[model samples]
Target chain A: MRRRTPAESPSKLSDVARLAGVSLSTVSNVLNHPTRVAASTRTRVEAAISELGFTPNRNARALVVGTTDSIGLVVFDLKNSLFVDIARGAQRRARGRGYSLQVGSSDSDVEQQAEHLRFFDAAQVSGLILAPMHDAPESVDRLRSHGRPVVIVNHDPAEANVCRVLVDNEQAGFLAVRHLIECGARRLGIVAGRRDLQPVELRVEGAHRAARESAVPVEVVEYPVDGLEPEYGDRMGSRLAALDRDERPDAVLAVTDMLAMTIISRLTAQGIRVPDDIRVMGCDHNTAAWGGAIPLSSVSLRGEALGEHAVDLLLDEIDDPAGHVHETITIGPSLHIRESTVGRPTATPPA
Target chain B: MRRRTPAESPSKLSDVARLAGVSLSTVSNVLNHPTRVAASTRTRVEAAISELGFTPNRNARALVVGTTDSIGLVVFDLKNSLFVDIARGAQRRARGRGYSLQVGSSDSDVEQQAEHLRFFDAAQVSGLILAPMHDAPESVDRLRSHGRPVVIVNHDPAEANVCRVLVDNEQAGFLAVRHLIECGARRLGIVAGRRDLQPVELRVEGAHRAARESAVPVEVVEYPVDGLEPEYGDRMGSRLAALDRDERPDAVLAVTDMLAMTIISRLTAQGIRVPDDIRVMGCDHNTAAWGGAIPLSSVSLRGEALGEHAVDLLLDEIDDPAGHVHETITIGPSLHIRESTVGRPTATPPA
Candidate 1:
């Protein structure tokens, strides 16, 4: 630390006024409303600020206000590709709204997710968005009663009237199954993510609807896995193979592309040709599903839109907590059809 | 914005001072330095604050010291997987240091990067870390001339004597080729990322060194594709197969694991098997790479460690700007040899 000279010992408005060649009242005006000061005067006062290397004590400022200026984002699993996109969307939207986002991974642990909220609350963040692994009843109550704007992302819980930003996971499942039926797939299987999320349950319901609507026998087999990883896909592929000849689904629909990619790879290991033998499809047009023998056809959720909407809702809540309303916005899982879903034995030319 | 009620305004310090039966300075001390004031007085002061929703203006505090409690991180390309990993690493590291990171993507344009820099400077970010796309000499000079702490993340211009955080990409390239050679991969083809990055050039150099050292008749073919997307992998696969069995290399080295996954998929489509028809490998053990028909042996660059080290270096620079210390830490591409490189080729399994 630099030693302070006797001249710098006044330690108040009068000392700063003397150093900046301005009156104490002018210094007060500069601190309160900088736009009211002249450019030349502003430059001089700013120079004095840099030379002194002073830090206006936040503790003193905190005496007047309750908290600071930052935002927190809580994601359940860092290991999932879906959350990577969600985090990106949130970061971009938060940047535009004039607050920095602090991201943390829960790794599907309820305790870790709650811990993040407590840490952010202690630091006094402006707002928060959490994608919980399970329905966090106690934690949700604490956050809501704590008097801050909190928007839930990707997943909906058992709570009443909380703000949510999510995509139509059911529509994604419907689209995948409908495409498989078009490809002459008489039977289908599913590689799913964690069952606790609302999207997971909703998607399965949509796929069941498509199968019943088509009057075909659909084999809904859940890949026995913990979190959504590639290993789950590999396990799901073998599950399909182990079934009876009539029970083996001609098409397998994954809740996530990561799972689909794994199923495709492992299925290929067992000498099954995609589409020609059994067609495998997935949701989330993640990069991993593409660039293969037959690029997997899947759904694309508008990531940036989900992020932008979350920010907009949070800002509205912060501006007027009582008068502001809570709402839910469900975006898309737009289809990006590729070669994997086409049920045909082909000798197509390489591009 | 909501209108403040008369009841909320009464919790002001002057009102609190009158209500608590104390002076204005005493109320201020109770808020600023709780220990300095009497506990009885502090309780009265705290009761008054909770009644009011007063948020102290950070701008007012910054006017006195000219410092914002945030850091700036501007990356070259948001679409690139490597850059995304770097940004995540930087953000994680920056958070541990109690600093919020402000991120911006330049989209491979020098003008946009500079514009982002100017905006960040005006916003008064505490410091900046940039991966500049276009070398804006004037802008770089101006940013450096200012007292803000700056560190360039990826690219080194050499003249600036700036702080940097990077891995030895060229050595990684050389090692990939050497590993292939050790496993009897004589014929070689390389798929590289954008040439603008110094790592690409370095990797090619490493490949050349290994071929030179082994004295094996190493024939190399370079595919200069667009950004390191999986599409590039698909395109490269056919190019490799277009050659006669004698001309086609027995191995393929992709700059990224994403590309490697695509290459394996496309090769399988063409009825050519991995490790049997050709050994496939890549850099960066990204999770998706492992989901393929064959597991690619990859050079794992410990992303979390890279993040932690960069923050340490940046903080050191911030603490002692005039120390003239140059510390260049070289990390690794630790090779993970898996199924794609050495396993026996099995029959193509079902999809």
Candidate 2:
């Protein structure tokens, strides 16, 4: 059980393989995929590793293999469940492909994003998946210039030469508004935050298109907010509730499920029924939608799918950098119908 | 920008300093804390870096400095907002201390947790903060044996010799049940999930203590579930709704906010008015409580504070490993009263 001192040089995989009288790949299989190695051979390798005190040095291995079995994921915010879902998806895919995913939250700060990128670069991760914010193209260029495989997730970068995966937000907005219209709505309201954001802009565009394509004449009103906090939704809800019954929009679609949940809460608190009076819908069918008192109807952005696709693209580039072609993959959004838009059934409860 | 080929050895800080006719520290300062170095010297160092195609090798730097400028955090579940809050707090603290935080989600898997620990070990992180699950003590031992400074978070380990930070779950349970009694409850029910979990057991114990301390005779019912999923909450809510008025508990306390939210949603759907028919409360005052249709009343675990404290302990260990004593710091929980426990205010809407 003696441990190596700082002054002593560490044993290598080669030393363990030589002592165990096994091939290098056999020793590697015993270390990484133990089930792939036979019991007797694995025991012999283990005894040799114990005798040699061999701890695999990832950096040295990376130098030999040209890459490490790790991928770095940089996201704007981890507080948002969407990013967590994406990380989970990416982690599962990476693990399946014999790679580990390391996550760093930029917290929406440009400096933090840059620092994470630098750290990942220094770590020499096999590849990187960035859900970027604020001056992303420059960051991507910097990473690419360093000969690192990069995959942009949850965003369509301005540069088309890099691999990217994003949810079709415009289609998400279209599906949400179209669903509301189908539920017999003439007046529609779109609750939006930060108009300059690409996803927000695309969703707004889709909403407008939905309004324009309506068979019956429909009025679409945009309620813009500074940000997507629940307080903003509460303010909007209070304002909506203050309006006369006839003046209020018959249907509303918040840009995100969080805003929609807050709005529903506020409206319900003020004695305003959800679907009975004004139907409501949201995008990013996040966990909040299901856990809310009124199950929220929302457009699914498919965060996990976006994450998995980003990793797929990253791995492809990592495996064959010479023949890699950068591509932008867009995942289509789907609609989820729930009690918020459609009132609960009057039938007896299930036994 | 011409890049060096893989065949060429990366430039060292000493080489950059020599090229710039400056000290090594000056080159280091320019790369790290740039404001500390003079602008003229920084420009010269930048020119030297560009001319030499310098890329700092983190592994080599770690070998020189004995550690990397990073901390590793392994959490049971990043999907839970509580863990995310902890990570956010730890990241901010680490960044302020000139360290980067790398996070990995175990998703309640033991092998995943072990993988993260191994990855961090390979990366030579300065320290580690682990929110462990399944054989945590052995895992912590394995990490400590590797000469890594470790701080356990969210879970108090079996080995008291290890540094750990956790919420006072027993006190959390007691606070929740005490609040219910103060709100005039004669019959109380504790809605718990996964009885084997230490936190759940502690909270239940605290609930019993609260009932014993009540002046009036109170009946405490323990309603145990297989797990904490929303569907389990729904099932429990239905069971409660089906009970006779005289048999039903006047107040119920769920182990987590997520369960409380789902219960509220299910109860309201079944014409069982919360607080009016049965006052309900929860522990872990997570974000779901605030975002729910009925703002939930619960006990706050102070996850961010837990995270921050974990980092502080980790840093202390890293700085003075020889003098560091193993300590278990437990943060007290507080109650948040909202519309769920007490019905919405009767006051008229504000102008």
Candidate 3:
């Protein structure tokens, strides 16, 4: 293959037409209205396109079409594999539907989130999928008013007019606590982060409900942290380890898998057995949970499903703006029991 | 704030000029060349822009300026938090330079990577930063031939004409094995993925160098796996467990932190104590290694630094393509010793 010089411009439609010995309109028909062109002519045009490496300018097409064949996904944080999984899922689905997915991480900053939203708006993307840090109804409304479809992922906004995809976080919490109770835990400690966050609040709510409904007299205690970092988990673990045997909770459920993994590591390092002393579990069933020393028991958040569904909803609205009716889709969570909660059964090695 | 209807188009320069009681040229100058406009006129134009919610169309601007105020970053996989960290670093740096960074994950598919490269080309972004799965010099050359600044990250291509930022995989391998040897290991087992991969091949080369350089005669064994999944790690662990006590290596070095974590988990499940019986270490000190049941000792790939340097090189080229010189910058890896390689000192709990 001969390398083209920097001074040489990219092959244009005219270049393709000239190479294929076809008129300009014929080349255009071959690209856009392919059915209108004869098979032989279309093949010739395609061969010419491949030979010349002619790539139609998406920006130029977007100007004509009023929207780009691109979807923007704004995630709160990319550090968590959950968001990464979501992006992977969204990207696959977007590609399958002949669109490119571009992602931006806001890093949990509200200002950064606004900047990303604005950038996508300026880009005039066909749609957006947002995993918001906070319920920014105004931002959603502003984007929607500009005729861009928006789908909120992993969040349920209070506004009824917006489309959203949410995991049943309450159900996730309920499952985690209920599983702990079933594992013979009478006292429970819920390691939670900021209560103001909707997911955290909802999970805590469901945990309390589980405690209230338990047949056994369970003492439910809450261990709050400023954030969900490993250091915070280490602190919680130290505080729990310091308690008298009778005062310590029989089991602990951390809000996230990372936190749970850290707490379990801390406990084990301090001479405390995992399931033997205090059972441990986490939420989000993250990829890291599977490879931990004690395989983590967690509630599955289904990040991939959330991402797929959000894109589905956004595309549906983009295809028919006026006729589209806003809807909120809720996905249910499930439990993944592992050695952290239940001692490893003597059997085949994990696959 | 009044809600604008979908029928309303985004505010244009004409609208801003009209509202600000300024000429169209003044409005254009205020946006394109702010210093060309008087302070009072600029303030009026800015206020009009704020009030009318004017977002300059990036696509239109790109057509005029030949590039958008955006940079494209294509990573091999989003599933790896290392890539995510790189994206985060690139984004922060790009944002500081008044540009938005858009990321696309190729998911380790060659076709997907080509598609992303094409997408960015059509988008006509200011520059591109890619962490390629395979060294495709032709693709890089083609992109560069179009006058687009390309900075390859985490991979060193054989071609010296392109700019690249790379972590020294050979050094990473040497660091892991040297640490294991320092901790009193006469025999070493390298758990690696496919040898076709450049990083794997380079790491193995460094591991051999370390073994050869050892003062005492050291035996080295290679345990090759099909892939880096946890299942592969588990299989490797089981195979090593079944080996005769004298046949098994005194220490093991996995190619990746993820693989090492899984191996440790599997070994511990089968009653093999890390460090006490066989020391274990890994290359690429990933974030998950910190919270594992046994804290993993590995080599730091410095993903963030790689990303930051890639962007710096890209932006420098984009700013002055003719004046820029292509350079391959190598980043050396450092060892991070933890409990997996050496028994923890009994002082204080992990923070």
Candidate 4:
């Protein structure tokens, strides 16, 4: 048998007022700002709320506050630590403001992303934070028509009239290649995943830019991986190892930390020495990359900051919908040079 | 200033029926089982549903169908690769069933876990999947009383009147130690984190059981870490490296793969040759263990399978409310012997 509440409808503010023998505004005051109500009266109102199981109806509440107390976040891949860090930052900020969060992963599928957006729209979340893969502009328009605020992450909003939180991927790429060049690496291998991805292309472009600007002549080779996974990296690692020592690139930069770690493992197993033979670098500065078999050198994309600012941007839009001016916030990337690039020994005891 | 629907109330079933010129049952039939209604009738009802923006009230619909179309999942730590794999599997299964998943991380805090649960209950998710850190029984009771079904992951239900999806932690522990013993290790050290945690205790119990079963007298030593993280592991690694060669154990197993990898890295940096000097093993078989500098030997806890089965258990409860009996599903663990134990060279080209 299904459970049912005795009340005809979900408990209401009026019902709470009636049960507390107080005016409607008194009950509203107690709920909206308990400090305004006398302590004894607030206790009575809270008891009434509990007795009636009165959940402040979000739809009705939204009409009063101009938005619901819930935020929705959609990511390209939830399994990635980069997105996990973003979600963590968003959660911290949302909790501080007494809001709940709903999360979804599109699994890199545009249709799935669209479906998640539709769900959020119907659920009536106050604001949305999306680390978009595709259809972001169209989806943003659809969501905005429902009178909800949307913020995009990772992607450069470009000319779109939307808020975006981004990291300078091109600068991160330039830093990686430039550092390798400074380390006397003239021949470089770029382990790229999915050319269609904007971040991947931008990183490659930045690497080429840095190479062209270098005083020494440099040759950059591209090694394409079919997917953003370790399996693809493993396959590429084997192929790279087969190249004669003279033919192989002296340094490598993987698109993501996962690729960097897997390729390094395979390369090490093939008797190739890291830094001594070929320095390896990765993007995203993932948590896994730090304590793995090799501490990977990476461009720290500041995932947590991106997530926090995205929520801040969305909330700003939600607060001033009519006069809201869309703004794009681009965060800079920092490089963490660890064992893979610098041949630094682990466990250096504190000074 | 707030957005409001034009209708006095969100369009009800009656509105959908009247607009389609059909009875309430016919509208319900069209929505729930379209095959029961004629194609023309179904089209008319769907059009009315779209026009009125009638989102079948989930609270009202649950009285008839016993459940909603949303599920909630909470993990103790989102940073752990173990929980990420679990979430990925749960999301995939939830999507296949046409349900949306909401995810939260408790950050190993009991109060945070309770808050997430209360939020999930208020949001009215039909079912919840939790990888709980503390207060399992109390939290389960609170949610159950609110007519929500919950499935616990990692923790054994242990005769509780609730559904649970667990991996054999005791067996996983036994396998780790037994494998080391089989590989000719006589003295062993176990890096344990928080003896109060049931899983940790259970794993330790299993390792002791394996040691007792060994024919040769084996010395088992316990090294306590304040937390189950890489920092603690690094601390423990330094201490072990400083021990006299004659006093140090020939093999070691950490409670988790995170600890194992860090310890291995630290020991390697301290000039300790793994396997040749002291073999290292870990539990939970995290993805990071695979591509780390050492390629750690670990007991694969099958986190994804546990997550997938937990969803199945929750859905079973939702589908057959009265007939559903709580079940404890225990998945077995497997050992992955890698370079940390075997120390084999990588990348031999396949013949």
Candidate 5:
């Protein structure tokens, strides 16, 4: 029984004006900005607006007076706490401005990322904050075509042309490796995330650079498995321990705290003493790393500051579309040393 | 410098119908159900809609027929993986039934929950799926007054008036303890979540019941710091190790798998050998627990099933109000013994 009673008709502005006993301009002023209208007339117009249930038509009105009180955020891997922290920061900033966020995750899939872009396009979001993976340059171009403001995160192009917020990964990696070296570690192993990822590349590059500069010939090995996490760390730790004493690396560096914790757990379980025998270090000083079984020694990638800056960049882009400048803002990679990387540096053999 | 424009001469259905070269009924059908209309006719009607930007007056329309397309989900902790999994399940199922879910987190704050309720009220969502922390039965009663549907998750008092989804916490607790006892664990510890929470209470009760039934006296220690997480587990583990050897429990059963992993990590780093010195167990076999880490023995709670059932309950309440029943569906807490709980039943107690 799908029957159509005539679609409900909204009260005309004329009706509202007539009911308010005012000129049409006065009614318009009241709807647009009541503060500009006289108090007595404003009261009448308000009464009429309440009576009519008029939430001024956004499409028609926005064209004349461009404003939509919404913000959009596109992220990679909503499951990741890093992204969640960024989203939380963005949400706080957005809410402070009396705006709400439309959040969507790409789940690390390019297709999914594009789909979210399309949805936000149709939604006509006022601003977009994206943390694109792998193919960011191509996605940036598509985002520009939508005629909406966009700010990128976790990416800083070697030759930049976009607003970005990120941590200094190369420095973070150097700090992590240098810490192990300072603690008397020489034979080193690093469990890096997908090598193709910029953070991993930068960190590894920095670690090797540090090795080249240092007198001790640091034998650095890439412990590559499927992902950057504890599970793979466990596997790597077990294999590393199986090596006869001299063959095993003196220390290991994990690209992420998650990997660091995993390696520590596995190595400890296998009767390999931490710091006393082998040192462990990592980047990303997330609370979970501190909160978990072993408080990991890590280079704190100040995610909150990055997040706050990302929001600031988005708001800047939103305020002035023709601002004519795009750049990446990098925050801290302060080192936090804990039980994992404690002992002094040891002699290392050349790789 | 905003000026009043004569509200574009009232365009009626007749004007749109004539312009689209379609009958009024055709336009009505296109608006109500585009699927029922021919593609060409639907395109024509859409063109007309764009030309006029005709918005059916919602206020007048509401007076005649009340319905909104959105569904609402109220959860206490959206940041939690357990809740996130449940949210994803709910969103997928709701979207399948042609409804979009508007999600809000209570943050375990009653005030925040009420504020979100107000937003949902304004949005006029068709149904609600609540993971409520406070007195929600009263809130549910208030929401029902608006003729909207509500379903509670993991709550009690499941009557024909409401629908709920819960995990068998008692069974989960019982199985975990039973497995430890079967493994010849002479002393046991239950590391649970927030003590005030209903789920925690039920799980602890189950553990108590199992210990009693087994005729083995078990010592239970409750740690109510923040929530059930890795950090809390680590704190608990470290504290347990610090206790007198005779007073310390042989095995620990974490309320959740994340807690279990944390406990494992903490004890290992502290030079305490798991299984040999202190066995550990946890509930909820999440991917994080299973991936790459030790194969943890856990009580698997059917989160996905609960999600699927929540949707069914919501849709039923929405489709046929009279036929809708408020009831709770309890799912499994099957025990899975892993390396953590290694001792067989009848093992001698340590002195």
Candidate 6:
């Protein structure tokens, strides 16, 4: 775990050149193209490099070799703790292999994503691990044409030529809805910010499939939101509270932990007993799912695991760029049951 | 919002040399030192540059100049959402100024922090925004000596020459304990990972100061943990719960929101009623504060604003390195009261 890089005062090529009594380019040639340098000059430069503990700047070395010991990652947003978790995992793995991670956030825009891609490409990074924004199939192609190894995270390009690590969104939806059904909730609701998203559509499909298999007919309703932020949870809570007693579903599932927890908070503030009057669940068991005012039952996306796997795949591609075969790794999500969807009575206050 | 970088096919200097019908070194000389190139050759190279839209690679340019259009940030940990919030704010400010943010987490290790510093130094970042690990005074000195502007975030270096953005930890601690005392809880317990750490010591000192001001006798018990993680919260929760009923503190304050929420979850699982049997609070008002099962009362560190201010300071230094005066910017913390410290009775279920 202890990685000691070279001394604080890095020995430069100029210092090596001074010690070897040669031009700076002679020292550079000794490192980059030793055969081009005179044997005596190369020997003198090598002795000086050892004496001074000189390490060439990776970027300068990369300029000659076309690659650096750095991995580039572009996520949708750093503010989202889920992406942070992924980045943390990626950093750990990248460091274990002696490579540093260079990160950029696209902020969920295709143009920004393309800009980031261009930067990484121009930087000549050894490899790229991207969580694409807006399904940029063309951008991926552009990245490939630049000749860097690529591993797309979370999204499935559904193409054989790209490597990706993905979660089974459809299975996650089925487990969540089926759990509610088994808990005696015949009416269920799903809240999604973007109904058109592929993951959202898959989750909805999974929920519908679960409803179809149930012995008792389950009525599934979908609630749409203008955005995917926590405030929408408050909006949904207010709208649901305003509904007729029988019109509101007894159980609700939110696409993310942030939205689910806020909805629970808003509903609890209105004096509704969670898992009693209405059960609530969420996906992406982020910090909110396990830590909220009412612990939310949720489907886990295993973001850290996704990130680690993506790095492994990207490194494999980097090692043998020409020999690399694109492959997809799909990880299944798990359900975490908590007080929000299960009845847990409060203890009597200490007398 | 749509900031476009130059074309993906970046024009190279070789292309300019080919167009100008000049040697590569002639074009290089024309760009780096126009006096070295013949007047006719320089004119041809300038015309070729205009026609080819060739801009020198940033890394190559950074070698001549001591900086690049990239801002480097080093944080303690990314999993701690507070840092993520700070990064989000820094990214926003840096983006507005046409600088790209390059982030690295030190994982709370001084060595890792130094490694990141070296990477940024070798990469020749325009400026550095650092949340130092273990309060290394020399690290900041080393960074500044390298000619890049350094803005220390979170921890105040106490040295006037070192720019910093800090949170008033002592004030935050006093607010949390005073709030508990105002709620009629005299006996208090504070769970901290390390009492020796500056932030932790300040918070504990704040609690003591608040106790001195309160009308009632406040017997504050300090509980130390191995680390500031959720597992430590569980450890503290079980130990507190094991204490004799009459000896237990009336209220508890955890060092972080994550720890506070976990303790609440553990205590609730053991049938203890929060804010009824014992009021609970936390600090750093991170995501766990709002999303936890009990909706913890916490002191907000305003991480985003801290990050924004850090970037502003760094950018100012980057813009006018010699003219810049290092000053500390302290932002006061605010308290957020929620259900963890305030009881809310649920409404009766519909008949």
Which candidate comes out best when scored by DockQ? Answer: 6
- Candidate 3 regions off by >4 Å? A1-68, A234-246, A261-277, A286-296, A338-351, B1-68, B145-147, B234-242, B261-280, B286-296, B338-351
Q: Judge candidate 2 at residue B319 and give its lDDT.
A: 55
Top lDDT prediction, candidate number:
2
Model 2, docking class: incorrect
Error of 3 at B229 (Å): 4.0
TM-score of 6: 0.77
lDDT of 4 by residue, B1-351 (tens): 123343334555556767898765566457544786799999999999888776643344433443337788989877777888788878776665556677778777776677677767777788899898754787888888999998999876554888787888999999999999999889999999977887888889999989999998899999989998679989988999999999999999898888888888888888887868899998877764544565688887777777777776776677556756667767788888877887645443322
**Per-residue lDDT of model 5, residues A33-111, tens digit only:** 4686789889888888678664433333333433425566777765565666676666555544444455566666675
Clashing residue pairs for model 4: A293-B292, A293-B293
DockQ for all models, in order? 0.07, 0.15, 0.14, 0.15, 0.04, 0.24
Docking class of 5: incorrect
Worst 10 residues of 3 chain A by lDDT: A57-66
Q: What lDDT score goes with residue B286 in model 2?
A: 72
Compared with the true structure, what per-residue lDDT tens digits does model 6 show for residues A140-172? Answer: 788788888788887777566878888888888
After the best TM-score superposition of candidate 1, give how far the Cα of residue A237 lies from its true spot, in angstroms: 3.1
Docking class of 3: incorrect
Over A1-351, each residue of candidate 2 has an lDDT whose tens digit, in order, gives: 458764565565556767898765566557555896799999999999899887643344444554438899999888777888899988887776667788999987877888788778877778899988643887777888898889888777667788778889999999999999999989999999977778888999999999999999899988888798889988998989898998999999999888898888788788788888889898877664444556688887877877877776776677567755666767788888877898764432432
Best by TM-score: 6
Clashes of 2: 0
lDDT of 3 by residue, A1-351 (tens): 234543455566556767898765566556545886799999999999889876553344444544438888999888777788789878876765557788888887886787778767876778999999789898998998888889898878887887888899999999999999999989999999967778878888888888889998889999898898778988888888888999999999898887898888778777777888999999887765444456688888878767876776676677557655666767788898877899755542333
lDDT against the true structure, each candidate: 0.66, 0.79, 0.78, 0.77, 0.66, 0.75
Question: In model 4, how large is the Cα lDDT of residue A162?
Answer: 86
User: What's the lDDT for candidate 6?
Assistant: 0.75
